[model samples]
Structures are given as C-alpha cells and as structure tokens.
Target: MIWALGIFAGAMVVPAVAAHASVEDSEVLAAYVQARAADASGALGQSARLHGAALALDPNNKILAARTLRQAIAAGDRPLAVQAARILDKAGELAPDGRMLVMAEALRRKQWKEAGLQIDGIEEDEVFSFLTPLLRGWLAFGARKGDPLAFLNQASTNALADAYAAEHRPLLLLARGKKEGVAELAKAASDDRAHSQRLRIAGAAILADEGDRKAALTLLEGDLPPIAIAREQLVAGKKLKGAIDTAQAGVAQLLVRLAVDLNAQNAGQLALSFARVATFLAPENSETWLVTSELLAAQDQHEAGLAAIANITADDPFASTAADTKLKLLIAAGRQEEALSQAEAAVAQPDADADDWARLGDLHVRMERPEDGAEAYGEAIARADSAVPGSTPKWALWLMRGSALIEADHWPEAKTALQTAYKLGPQEAQVLNYLGYSQLERRENMEEAERLIREASRLQPNDAAITDSLGWAYYLRGNLIDAIKTLEKAVQGQPADVTINEHLGDAYYSAGRRIDARYAWNAALVYADEEAAVRLRAKIEKGLKPELVSP
Candidate 1:
C-alpha cells in the first residue's frame, strides 16, 4: 500500500555574509555565484565541485560547508560528501543528511558502532524518525549483536512505519539465510495492503535459488511486464538475483523504497538525496539506478538521467523501464526526433511487444503524424489480440487508434474503431466522450451523440473536455440559453483551454452577445496554436458565420 509521509522542508537558506574586499574573497564569491547558477540549472555535480572550491577558500563558512555536503551527496560524489560531512561535523552544523552520509560511510567500513552513534545523533524528525528503527535494525544485523527483527518489530503509531517494518523484516531474514525467511516473505507478499513488488521479486529469486521453482513461479504470477520478464528468466533456468542478499543491500533497498515514496509525493530533492545514497551503497542494484535516473529527469537533469540509466544493460530486468524513461527524458528535452528514432528501433525488434508498438504510436501522435500513429496503433492492437486470444479487447488501444484516425481524417475507419471501443468498454468515460465528440464534429448520429455525451458527463462531471462537449451538443440542438450556461461553466472549469474558450465564444455569438463573444475569442487566441489562432482571429474580426449557427 502507498503510504503518505510529511514532506521534509528544503535545505536551510544560507544568510549572505558581508566579505571584506580582498582578492581571496572575490575569488570565493565568484565560485559561490557559479555554484548557485549550476545548482539552479540542475548541474548538480558541477555545483558540488564549485561549492567545494568555495569552501576550500573559506573553510570556516558553516553555511558553505552545509551546502557543499548536500550538493556532494546529491551528485553521488561520496568522497566529496564525506569531506563536507567532516567539515560540518567539526563545526557542529551537521544536518541529518550530513549525518546520513557519515553513517553510510561507517556502514561501508564495517564500523557498526559508529553507524549506530550517527543514527542516534540524527534528530528524530518526521523523516528520520521513520527511518531510525530500520537503520538500527540493519546496523544490528551487520554487527551480529542484537536481534534485528526485534528492532524492526518495535510497534509504532505511524501506519507507514509499520508497513515499512513488515516489508524489511522479511528481507533481513532472507539476508541471514534463514529458512523462515521464505515463509515470511510469502506471507508478506500475500498481504496486499503491505505488498511490494520488490518483496515478490526477492522472494521469487530466493525460492528459485533454493530449488522451489514452482513457488517462485507462483510468487511472480502476474501480467506486468517485469513479472513476465522474471517468469521467462526462471523458465530458461536463469537464477534471478535477489535485491537484498546482505545487510548493506538491505539498507539500500530501504532507502530506495523511501526515495520512491518521496518522489510520489513530489519531494524530488529529498528523493534524489535518498536515491543517491542508495546508489552509493549498492551500485550493483539496477533498481536504485532507475530511481536515481527518474528523480534526475524529474529535476530536468535529462542528460544526467540518461547517463544514470545507461548503467542498466540490455539483459537487465529494468531495461524496459529504463527505455521508457529514456524516451520520456528525450521528449522532455525537446529531442522528439531522437525519441521517435528510439521508438522505431524498439518496435523493429523481433520480440517487441504491444507496449513497444503503442509507444511508437504515441510518439508519432506527439510528432503530429496522425496517419503514422494510426498505423502503429493498429500493429499494437494486432499484437495485443495475439497475446491474449479471445480475451476482452483492449478498449484503450482502440480509442487511441480511433482518435488518431479522426485526426488523419479517415472518418469511416475512425468510426469503426470508436464503435469497437464503445462495444468493449461502454462505461469508460474517455471512450464515450471521444466517440460522441467525433460524431458531433462530423454532424453524424446527432441524437446518439447527445445520449453518449450525457452519459460521459454523468461519469465525469468535473472533466472540462467532456463538459465542453456537452455544451457544444446543446448549441448544435439550437438550445442557445442552455448552451451558453453550460459552456460558461466549462470555461470556468478550464479558462485557458483553447477549445473550451472558443466554444464559449461561438455560443456567445449565437446568442447575440457580440461583446462577450469577442472577449472569449480573444482569450482563446492568447493560448491557441497557430492553426487555432488563425481561426480565432477570423472569428474575432467578422463574428461567427451565419451558416455555421443553427436556425
């Protein structure tokens, strides 16, 4: 189950200190300025390097040391992080993250006592309090002193902490090679509320290693692409490597889980910090790298993100996920051509699945090649049909293909696809809305279109696009008063939506409110694409055409 945690506040802003006019001060200031700029641009490695340089010039600067420690950890520069952590610790300004870096180093050196002290020193805030017990447990396991399970099982009021405990207990047990680990893992995997894919994969790997191949296969029984890949590997007699086979790897897994949870909550920086630490601890774990790459991409560090995922080879279980992430990163970087090329290459592979073809279709649509998109989606549909014979048809794929066909002006083909989608998923609001709106635009089956739109509106009352479709249907039926009212509500829901605003403009002009019509048209023009802008400008200049309105 997904658990919500309170977001940690960002790093404390360093108050600027007035520096005496000197050559050294000027050099330090220049480096500091460059560091801030690099940080802003997501050049985290360069930022850390620059910050370290500035700190070297002014070693007594506590704020600079803190910033350096943070950026160093963020950049996955362990040596730099350790240096900055030492500086911060000496000055008694070490934050929890700095302490974490030091603790991580302690763990690496097998200094269990030092790691425990560092964990103890961490102020029990929302973020660390949740982790403190887990860290203690891992440290105990590594030291072979205390009962790690007891530390993990310590009851907590926080449900999220308890959930984490349930996940980690089994992992720690497995790491110790205990037979009970398999049963505990199976039990944990069966608890849907506390279930994790990591647990299942780990359990499956352990079971396979212990010759319980059937149980391993059962553990990974799912249609998800990752599960499928694992199952195929198992069938081929390949031993699936478990994520956590040691105390250090267990700690890394814990950090990776926290990183994922924090990223889900939109805490990108904090997530990156955790992910980087995990990477440092378990560089062999491709999952940590994947999380690191995704978090980097989210922060607009596309190049770094790509570089991070490059570590995952073609045979890695995470390769597919990495490829998908790479496509997104390329698109976000405005390298759509590169993304399109990758998508093409992916679908050209002999074993390419429906997902690969669908990705190509999506890329084509993004490039405005609607006809190509429709063709690619058709291939995806064929593959999907072959993959699951006589199963329920994939309504979503048909809907996408239909939308692309409509964009390409293949009306008959579009209608057939949309009808197929409606047949498969009549209750799906998106399918209903797309089919209804496409028919409305063509002025075909007007009565049926109205019925479909009304049902779609009922299913998704807050959806501005569906609401606009309903409003447009009213206008087409010559109910100008109701049209204006409904269209106004649609505009309120999405004021900047070009289609909604333009629809409102049309309704206003049809109702003889010329001034309101012009205002709405102008608003739409502000946000419209080139083609829509030209049309909106014409409507603003001469009002709606007489023949376009219902009599």
Candidate 2:
C-alpha cells in the first residue's frame, strides 16, 4: 500500500552575524565567507568543509554550528553531522531534526532504549505527535514489550497517518508469524482507496505466505494499478517474497518513509543519508535502492547513482525501472555507447515489453542514429499494438513515432502519426506545439498552424518554447508587429535559449529594429547549436538575407 504522506519539513535558515567587538575572530569570519561562496558555486563538499572549520574556530556560536550541521547533511557527511550534533546537544539547542538524526544513529546501532530516549526529546509538533506513537509501536514490536496494534490503532487522529499505520502493522505482524491481526488488516485494506493498492499487495503477500493462494490471487485481481499489477504478476508467477521480518528491516521501512518526506521538501542529500541507512539495514529492498539512486543523481553524483541502481537485482520487481534509470544516468555522464549497449540488451531480452522498445528508440535518438531510432520506434508501436489491439495507442507513443519519422524526413508518415496524436489528445500542449511547429517549418497549413500554436500558448502561457512557436507562426504569416511583441516575451522568459533568441532577432529585423536585431543575434551566438551558430554569424556579419529583410 502506498501510504503517501506529505509532511514538509522546512529548512532552517541561519542568520548571518557580523563580527562583534568581543568576538573579533578574523579567521572565523573569513572561513564563513569562503563557505558561503562555496555553497553558492554548487561546491557542497567544499562548503561543508569550510563550514566545519568555521564551526571549530567558533564552537560557541550556535548559529554557526547549526549552519555547519545543515551543510554537512547536504554534503552527506554523517561524521560531520555527529560532530555538530554533539555541540548542539551540549548546548540544549538541538531541534527536532537534529534529534531525529541522533535517533537514527541509535537505531542503526540497535540501541533500542537510547533510540526511545532520543524520540522522547523530540519537540512536540504536528509530525512529532504523529511519528512518536508510530516509532514507539515499532520499538514495542521490536522489543517484544506490548501489542503493536494498540499503538498503531492510536494513530487514528490523522487519516493519512492512520492509513500508514494500518498498512504498516500487518506487514510487521506477518513478518513476526502472528495471525491474530489478519481480520483487522483485511478491514484496513478496504478502508481507503488512496493506499488500497499497496494494502492489497501486502494483504496478498500475507495470504500467500499462509498458503491461501486462492484468496491472495483474489485480492490481487481487484482494481490493481500498474505497480500493483507488477506485484500481482510476481505473486501469481511465484516470484514474490515474504513480508519484512527483521527489526532492522522495520526500522529501515520507517526511515525510507521519512526519506520520502524529506524528498518532498527538496532535501536531496539529507534524504540520501536516510535512504543510505535504510539500505544498510535492508540491503535487499529495491525501493530504498531506487530512492537512494535518484537522490544521488539529483545531487550530481552520477557514478554513485549508478552504483546504487546496480544493487537492484533482476529478480526485483523494480529492476526494469532501475535499468531505465541507470541507462539515462549513463547517457547524462557522456557514456552514450554504454547506454546504447544497455538499451540494446534490454530490447533483446525475451520478455521485453513495449516500454523497453520505446526506451531503446529514445537511446538511439540520443546517439544520433536517426534511422535506427525510426526502426526502434516502429518496433515499439508494433509491440504496443499487438499488446492492446486497436484501441487508440497511447498518444505519447504516437507522438514519439511522429518525432522519429520527422527526424528521418518521412513527412507523410510523420504527419499522419502527428495528426493521429493530435486527434487523440487535442488539448495537450506538447502535441499542439510539436505539430504546429512542424507545420510552420514546412510552410504548410499556415492558418491551422497559427490556431494550434496560439492554443498552445494559451494553455502554457509561461512556457517559453510554446511562446517561441507562436512568434514563429506570426512571423510566417507576415504579422511583424505581433511577431516582434511575442518573440520579445519569449526571449525575456528564456534569455539563454538559442532558438528563441534567434527567432527574436528575426522578428526584430522584420520590424526595422536592425540594431536590436544584431544585439539579439550576438546573444544567440553565445548558446547556439552548431547550425544555429553558423546562421547567427552570417546574420551578424551582413544582416538578414535580402528576402528575410524588412519590405
């Protein structure tokens, strides 16, 4: 059951302090400035190091210590967090988050009582109130002290948290070999639709473990989503595993859930540390590995992300998604050959699905193999059609096929597929943008193209790409005034976009603003693609070609 809870923890901002008469520490101030500069430059590790040095030089400054701790967390420096935590704790200034880190450390060490004590020190807040009992319940179950259901049942005050507890308690019960809570779990599974899929999957696991395969299959057949379908397939095919059974795994699940909360708050590196701890506790859990890899990638640690994704074994239900993620990371790291090889391998697998073929097509396109890309996209469409038979294939799949065909210069087939996609998803901005832009480039269906481009602009008013298309459509229709106004907006919204700036330059020249046109072309050269750069340089040297100049 996906008990999706959104509890955002706002980051604490440290206020900067000027050097006081009594605290005239030049070294500390200099280190602080260096740390700030490092943070602004995206050098998080350097920031963390400099902040630590500053904190060491001014240990008594609570604000500096707290800032250092935050930087350390962002850099994934556990030892540094511990060092900062000690200073905060000694001064009785540790906040709820600082306490949670200490609690996680205690949980890691299997010091149950110490973990409980740390939980007790958490400042009473909305999340704390919900989390406290849940933590205590998990501890009780782990420690064999009291009924987990009693503490879990107390979570009814909040609907979402209650749903989480309801979904969580059963997996723990089955893991511990207790059947007394089966009835309650079944009821909880039917309680809320938001989390029902995960609950049903959990229920199926429990039932299957108890040798009730028929009942388990029944649960799996009801209103199953895609992820649940994966679980159902694994369960029916006898490839699924039993529920999480260890105290460590239980704690890891808690930490993973907490990591999700932190991710929602955009605390990527801090969330990575929590996810890493979860993986350390339950190395076989594919979910934590996926999250850890994504967090690593978000922090620009591509190699580390690949390492985490590598841990997803073929037997895991998440393996395909993990493979796809790994391939993208490889491409991002400039290992296009490696990524293409991986994509080729995936499509060659006996059971590769339409999605796998689609991914392969994308990889080929990225590698600049347009013919191969067109062939792969065709195979994907064929597979999808064979799987679903005659229903309007996903608009996105058709859209992708259209794009590939366009790159291959097969205009008739490309136009057919794009029209099909546009018919299916008439209101989709991207579909409107691509089809309209393509028509503009081909200099056909000028009136229809203008309507489609204008509709796209209305749907996505802030989208610079869509605005660029609208401006281009106006330029093609000889509406120089409207073209100039719209292109200016597009350039303002995306000043660094080479194509948008080029269009703006064209609009300016057509409107007799030759000086502004030259300035825009010069700016476009800064970020232009090779072809665009050539065109921009020609325009700057001799102005727009005669036919393209103002009448």
Candidate 3:
C-alpha cells in the first residue's frame, strides 16, 4: 500500500500531478500527490497508498514501478516490493530495484543464503557495480561461509568506487574477525581524507583484540566518532596505527552528513567533532569549516561557533555562505558591531560575488546598522531580480531588510520586507511570530497579529520566545488565566532562561497570583547579576509568597 501524509497549512506547495488529466480525475490525483508530498516521515503507510494508486493508473510507467518498489522496501513490505520487482524484471531492465528488493526481503526474513545468492549471479560485471555485494559480504560473514575479512576486502576493492561502500568494508571485515585485513584495506581507502577516521578506527580495533589494551584505549579515545564494530575488531587481533597518515582523505565525510541534516540534534556534537577533524585533516576544505560553523551556531554555541563559521575565506566553495553564517552567529551572540564589520569585509573583497553584497547588507540589519544593511540588502535584491530564474536569492534578503527596518522603527518598510519573507518561506515560525509581535506591540492589526502569533505558537510549541509571545498575546485579549498557564509551562521547560522566567512572573502578577508571582521573581533574582539581582529583590519583597498547593 502506498502511504499518504496529512496536509500542512504552513507547507503551501500544491502537489504536482501527472501532466494533464480529466478535471475530476485530476483533483483526486492531486490529492494523492499532495498527501505523498506532505512532510510526514512516519506516514509511510499513507505515502505507499498514493504511490500504489499512481502505479495502478500508470502500470506501464517504469519510473512509477521503481518508485513503488523502493517505497515498499522502505516500508519493509517485502511481498509488495518483490511483486513490483518481479514485474520490472519481466519488463527486461534490472536497474538494481530487483536486487535490493530480494536482499531487503531476505534481510527481513533472516534468510542469509538466498540474500547472498541474489547478488552472486552478477559478480563479473564491473558495470553491474553497486553496494549490494558489499552488503552481501556482511551476510556471508555472519553465515560463516568464508573468511569474513578476506571476503569483504576482496569484494570492497572491486566495489571501492562508491564511498559509502568503501567505508563500510573495513567495518564489515572487523565484524568478520579479521584484524590484519583492516590495516590493509585502510591503506587502500586512505586516499580520501573524509574516510581516514574509519581507517584509524579499524586499525585501533584490530590492536585491542591482540590484548594491547593500552594501545587500543589510546586509539579508541582518538577523535573519530565511535563505531559499533570497534569492539569486534579488538576481539580479532592487535591494532596498529604507528604508520597511519593523519592527513589521509575521506576525513570530511562525517561533516558532509551533518551539513546535509543541520537540524539533526543527535548528530550535532558528532558533526562538530567531524568538522574539527576535517579542518585538521584538510585545512583547505573551507566548505567543511563552514558546515562546522553552521552546526555550532544552530546548537547555540555562538562565540566559538562564529569563529568556526567566519573562517571561510573567499576562495572557498561556500565562502559567501560562511561569511553570511558568521554575520548571523555574531548577531545571535549579540556581538552586533562585529557582525556589521564582518559583513563589510565580505562585500569589500575583490572576488566577492553579488551574493556577498546581499549577505553583507543582511548582516548589517542583524547588527542594527540599518542604513548600511538596507543599502546592501537593496544591492542583493537588485542582483536577485536580474539573475536567471531560480538563481536569485531574493527572499532571504527581503526578509533580513525588513527585520533591519523593524529594528530601525521604519514601520512601512518593515511590513514590505515581512510580506516578502512570507512569500519566500510561508511556514517559517520565527518570521510569523516576529511580524505578529511587532503588530501587537504597535497596537495595530490586532486580529491578524493574534492569528499569526497563534500559528507560530503551534509550529514551535516549545520555543521560549514563541511561547512567551503566545502568552502575551492572550494577555492582550484579557485572557489572563490562559496567559498564566501558558507562561508557567514555558518557564518550566526552560528554567534557566531569564526571558521565560520574567514573562511567567509578569503573567502571574497580571493574573493576581501575587504570592506565586513573588516566588518566580525571587528565583529570577537568584540567577541574575549583582546589579540586576538587587532590583529584582524589591519585587520579591513587595509580592506575597503563596502557600504550596497539596497534590
């Protein structure tokens, strides 16, 4: 069954349907497309239903068939996937779909031999080259059909063109109980700096097995991300990296994964470490440095984060991006002047592209340098307008300029920029809240402001600033009780956040919970600076302390 996703109001994109069709059928098809396109990762069942519908309608379409098979594989529906692949194989073009379908089914059923047999028939053709064989090597090792390390080493060398396969080979060998093979395979795959960490890890694992605990401990503590197979590698033999090249290739591979998924919280620390390793391995990989900086900034490690981001010189592939990130981080870190100056330097560089100018202007706005930021933003806007379609980076500049104008108290100009930001990224919670808060603070467009703030709150339920805004919005409408409850929840989630505590205290006082309010106020004072704490003490003294409620 093809899966579908629930519609998202923030995701304004209409699902693209198959070219043209009858009006009635088109609407139904569009709904299916829209459901499939919705960002519901767990709605695989729904997405599968849509794909199935499309496949049934266009049974002759190879791409549609392949898509269905892939979806089935992802959903772990082996019977459905096998059905699709068998049909494709009958169609005479076996483009890896059937191969993976068989393997996936075999893996699901734990049929190790049949799984190995699926990829075995195509062993000679380098053109049939894929990662399936390397995966099979793992299955074979587990089955004890051959020497695990030797099998993986030979298969991997033949399939080394794919970077992912290359990295997995050494680990697979470790899994198969071959310690010395690790060092040999590591040497072959060491040309890519992004992969060096895996090689080093494999080497260390081999040594630990030989009872060289101290040597293994040193290698295990090395900068590489921990791999599950390291334990097995040590069980095999003695690890050695005395001749390992620290500057080997493939060290940056981990950083690349993080860059592809910057919002992945679990990968944040590992990404930062990989970025550092990449920076150490290949100082020339400026893009890796920028990715590192971006990850740090996203994690709110601003000071050192900005330092990582700002290091990208103009010669790098993502120089403008790095410089732009640096400006944002500086602003986020509250080092506004430094952000402004950094922007200035970026725009001034001789090789600085038009993007550099726009990015610089946006930085100015973030730093509260309105005139300069506005001017720079305008240059970027003009460049974006003049560029080829899909090439103009207009929307972000427009939004930044608007934010800058808001800071400058230029109401009309700010509104225009805010609207532009909406057009570019309609679902952005921060932009929605910011615009809504501005309108509320100015005491105009009250209804629209409330709606926008509510929407923002829905999108970011746990965000401290958004939660505070929702509570305040409620307060504005005389919903004092709701304000108190909402603000208190926000405070609880972020106990260390001064903003949340202050807002909660204010809401409590407004709702006539004077004693409860006093306790919150006192707590805030305890975490405040000496001068700030002194002033807070007055509020704590004036308010009554409420009695504890029994559960």
Candidate 4:
C-alpha cells in the first residue's frame, strides 16, 4: 500500500525569505557564511550561528524558523530545539514535525499524558489529521485506557493510506483478545470486494479459530473471480494450474491493483505476507506461486522458491514457467548439474515452445556445455523461423549460439552464426565490432576484418575497443605509419585502457621512437595486470635489448 501522505514528510520547501535590513549585518552574515562552510564539512557547531544569523536577517521568515528547529534537532541541543519551536508557536503557525521531537523526549521520562497533551497542542490539526489521531491512539493503547481497539480501528479506517494505522489495527485488537472479533470482522468484510477475497480466503484458517468450518466453506463459495478463486486453491500447496486461469482477466486485474495499492500504501511488505497466505491457501495456483517465486527472488530467497515450484503439475499452462523458475533458482544456487538436467528434461517435453528451447540453450551455454547449447538453439531457430515478426525469437539466440561456438574454439562456425545475427540486426555496433575483432585475432582475414572493424568504429566512434582493434589490425598488416597514428588516436579516446596504452607503446617502438615508446609502456605498466606489468618492466630493464612477447 502506498502511503500518499508519507511522501509529504520529505523536502517540503519553505518559501525563500526576502532580504531584510539585517541582511548585511556584519556579525550575523559572518556567522551565516561560516555556518554554510561548516555544513559543507559536516559540522553542527556552525548550524547554531547560521540559525541566529538567518533569523536576525529576517525575523518573519518561517524558513529560518524551520531550518533552526531541524538543525537544532540534529545537533542534539534540546534548548535550541525548544527555542525554535517557541518561534513557530509565537507566529501562530507550526511545522507538522516541530512538536513531535519534543514530545518524544517527554515520553522518555514516562510523561505519557504530557506527550498526548503536546500532540493536541499542535496548531494545525487539519494538516496533521492522520498523525494526530494515530499518536493519540498509541498513547491510549499504552495506558490501557479501555480497549484501544475502537480508537485504533477508527484511526486506521480514517487514515486509509497510513501504514502505521493499518499495521496497528490487528495489534490493538489482538492485545484485547478479540480473536472472535477479528474473525467476525473478516466474516463481515465478505461484502467488500476490495478486501473481500482476503477475508474469504483467510476465513477457513481463521474460522478454525472459531471452530466454524461451515462458515469458512460458506465464504469460500462466492462466485469470486478466477484470480481470487484460484488463489483460494493455491493455498493447497505452492504451485497451481488454476493460478493462471484466475490471473487471466478480472481477477488478474484485481491482483495488480491490490498489489500496487499495497506497494503504494507502504503495505508492500504486508502485501507480500498476504500473498504468501494466498499462495498457501491455493497451492495449486501456478500464477500465485509465480508471484511468490518472483517475490522470493527479489528478496534473494531463490532456494526455498524452487521448492514451492515443485508443486506444479505437468498439465498446468504455467508449468513451463515454473520449470524456468526452478532452473533459474538452481543456477542462482550454483546447482548447475540440476539446472542442466532440468533443461534436458524440458527440451525433451513434446510441447516445448521456442521460448522453452531458447531457455534450454541458454542454460547449456551458462554451464559451458556449448554443443548441447547449440543443439537447443537449433531447435529454437527451427521453431521460431516460421513465426511472424513479433513471435519470432529475437536475435539474442543467434548471438548466444555464436558466443557458445566461440568458446568451443570453432572460429569459423562462430563467425557464421555471428554474421547471420549481424545481418539480421546489422546496426548493433558491439556485435559488428566483436565479429571484426574476432577475425583480426584469427590473423588470417586482415583486409575484410579491417573493413568490418573500421565500419564498427565509424558507427560507434567513442567505443575504445573498436578503435583499438582497427588500429591493431593495421599494425598486424605491417602499415606501421598508419598503425602508429590510429593507435595514438585510440589511446586519446581511451586513456585508461591498459591494452590500448600497451598497443600505443608498441606502435611507438615500431615507428622507431624508442624513448616515447618506453614512456607509454611505463604508463601502461602502472595500470596493467601482473603479466603485462612484468613484460613492460622487463622491456624497460633491458634498455637496448629486446623482450619476448606472449599470446
């Protein structure tokens, strides 16, 4: 649930103050300037002087008063805080937070009634509606003055968007031993669809408290939309086919609404709790399980989530989604063997779709099982090639296949895959650059490789590696003059790239500028890895002697 009012707590600006006769007051301005400098250095001593100076310059400025109060609160100077609060009070206006700080201190001494009085004293009751009522209810709850149930419930209802009020609702009732009342409230809430599904679903469990299985069944009998109805079943375990059916139209829409409301109202955590309950109730609801799985993933509890997905059935529409979730969980948990096995099982499924095949392929690639990955990619290509543009698998599969082939050390095959992907989406300069660089590294296709690399650099001129690759290709072709110039350009574009700097150093040496070459190599040595640094260091030590290069 999003707390709309909570947003009001931060950075509400005070209108800027107009300069007054005291603006140029030397002592005050000097204090103010000193304090500004102090603030930059994270000091509080200057805050006091600055407050005094600002107030002196403009006695009527609420901005000064508010800043003084806030700074005093941060400085741990109660006397200054009291002084600032007094100023706001004397002006017949108040900041919503002004008195809360003082009241908090008063409560430390068991001055409960005093704190309550302080809350009532805030001048702007209308602006502080939710806060004032909630605070009063808290004080009442602490003092055990009657049951705070009535007060807190009223406050929660009035402050619908207030998280504290909502969370406090069950607490107040629970302390009063109102299990029956809470259960009764759930029963009564059966008519409010906004909160109806929650009530009905919780009915069976909470009704167990009332020993009324009949009422639980009655509440569950409503022609509730698919999502709510499906979720009712989701509680059976974790995964469910019905979860997808429920999330289809009306019920799915409601879930999103409820989810967003819970998120916006700061009830996101509460929503998660409720979602868990909902999933528990309808354990067969795959959609609900999916939601829970995603939530668990976001919370970094992917392992337990895989267990939840284990409840899904083969006939479920969302079964593959559950499989994917399990695969991801296994991967995240470092259970690569399990993920690979699961991928193979999914690949063998008779109804496997293009997406399923793609996922299988990607899983293989992730595990460094390139041959298997390529076979899975092949299946996806055969399947998706006949689909419409939007239904066709994106170029990513081709890229993945290409990458797998590269890792398999099949340079020609990798080139073929990459070239196909490039032509499909030729504008991706990274792809173009990688293919070009790969060819250059192969050392057997210099001219065509140079053409591709130069084209990539032209498209993405600021890209450091593409520029470096073009320059490196030139050097490999024995065009030392052009290589030196282009590598120098590459160095200018990527001053921090150790490899580019190293290449520049080599270019300088090849151009017969030994001293300049040594300087560039010295710079490269400072940032290069141990191996590169060792090579450069040896080069420097040898002076006129040569150093061996390694692949």
Leading candidate by TM-score = 1
List of clashing residue pairs for candidate 2: 1-198, 1-199
TM-score of each prediction: 0.73, 0.59, 0.45, 0.39
Q: Per-model C-alpha lDDT, please?
A: 0.79, 0.72, 0.57, 0.59
Q: TM-score rank, highest first? A: 1, 2, 3, 4
Candidate 3 residue-wise lDDT, 46-97, digit = tens: 5556666666665555655666665554433445556667667668654543
lDDT of 1 at 420: 96
Candidate 4, 227-252: lDDT as tens digits: 23334444443332221111111122
After best superposition, candidate 1 residue 462: deviation in angstroms? 12
Instruction: Tell me the tens digit of each residue's lDDT in model 2 across 379-486.
Output: 877787554221224677778889988888888999998998899889988999999999988889999999998998998999999999999899989999989889
Encode model 1's per-residue lDDT on 293-348: one tens digit a residue: 88888778887788788877766555667777778878888899889988999889
TM-score-best of 1 and 3: 1
- Candidate 3 off by > 4 Å: 1-252, 255-274, 280-288, 291-317, 325-354, 387-393, 423-425, 522-551
TM-score of 4: 0.39
Could you tell me the lDDT of residue 231 within candidate 1?
Answer: 79
The most accurate candidate by lDDT is 1
Question: Candidate 3 — worst ten consecutive residues by lDDT sum?
Answer: 241-250
| Worst-scoring 10-residue span by lDDT in model 2 | 1-10
